[model samples]
Target: MELLPVRPTIKTPAQAFTGDVYMTPIHSGTGPSRMTVALVRFTPGARTNWHAHAVGQTLHVTEGVGLVGTRDGAVLRIHAGETVVCPPDEQHWHGAAADTFMSHLAMLEAKPDGGDPTTWLEPVADELYEKANQQ
Candidate 1:
């Protein structure tokens, strides 16, 4: 067995998110493994841009309330201890609610070819975001 050292926290880039977001990578599988995991934190009103995963993604909320929205105008309010699963290639976005900080364990798999597993699209429009908060 190998013991992994703690990874440093880093601020998420503006190109992929709005407001303040941070992440600490947990595990990245090597060789025959494709699984990857990270702990992501979002400040109040912070959220990711529209994106999709090549192999789907799972998020387990660890603290505070958050929102997850899909392209079909469906918005879900998630709380600590809840888990949400997005199917492969389904466009979606997630983030903290308007008045609370949030954190979650983000788990997904890297493509077999070792390419980026996520396809990031435009940021969520303010109108839609506000509507999500209202939901």
Candidate 2:
């Protein structure tokens, strides 16, 4: 057993998210391990753009409330202690609700051939957010 080197927190890119968001890499396995873990935080109303993972992703909510939405119009409200699994190539987004801050640990598996783990698309529009919030 060993301790991983510490790293600075990272701001989520504007091209991938809206509002205030941050992430800290926890671990990134090398070679055949092919896994990554990150702690992500989102301020109220902050969220990711539509995206998908090559090998899918999992999220374990740790604090506040979270909203996960899919392109096919499914929206799930998640709270602390909840886990969300996003299937590979499923276009979706996740973030904090408008009234609360949220935090989660994201787990992702990297493709063996070095393909991008995530493919980011357009941002979530206000209209969509409003509609989801109403549910």
Candidate 3:
């Protein structure tokens, strides 16, 4: 196997995210592999919009606390060294906790053809966020 070069970290677009978020490409699989990996860092109170993966998505928390919320109002708090797998087509959003900076390794398989592997929807509103985070 060949050694892969590090890719530049890109600030996540506001359309797909709220607040500050960045992503560093890890491995973009070649050919039919279609596997994509990135290290995503989220600032305090930052989060992604509602989204879904074409195949599926796996998130491994590396630092700080993270919040993974589904469309059903269930939000799970995941800590460092924890992992979460978001099933394909499951609309959900994830990001740093309200008071913490978080980072996670996001892994997913892209469509064999082309285009984005994830379908991004609307931003998670404050009311939803607050309600979802409630115990």
Q: Which candidate number maximizes TM-score?
A: 1
Write candidate 2's Cα lDDT for 7-78 as tens digits. Answer: 789998898999999999999988878999999999999999999999999999999998999999999999
Candidate 1 weakest ten by summed lDDT: 126-135
Model 2, residue 6: displacement in angstroms? 3.1
Task: Write down the TM-score for model 2.
Answer: 0.97
The candidate, 1 or 3, that scores higher on TM-score is 1
Q: Taking the tens digit of each residue's C-alpha lDDT, what string does model 1 give over 1-135?
A: 999999999999999999999999999999888999999999999999999999999999999999999999999999999999999999999999999999999999999889999999999998999999997
Report the CA-based lDDT of candidate 2 relative to the real structure.
Answer: 0.94
- TM-score per candidate, chains pooled: 0.98, 0.97, 0.95
The candidate 2 region of ten consecutive residues with least summed lDDT is 126-135
List, residue by residue over 61-87, the lDDT tens digit for candidate 3.
999998999988789998999999999
lDDT at position 4, candidate 1? 100
TM-score of model 1 (CA atoms): 0.98
- Candidates 1 and 2, the one with greater lDDT: 1
Q: C-alpha displacement of 101 in model 1, angstroms?
A: 0.4
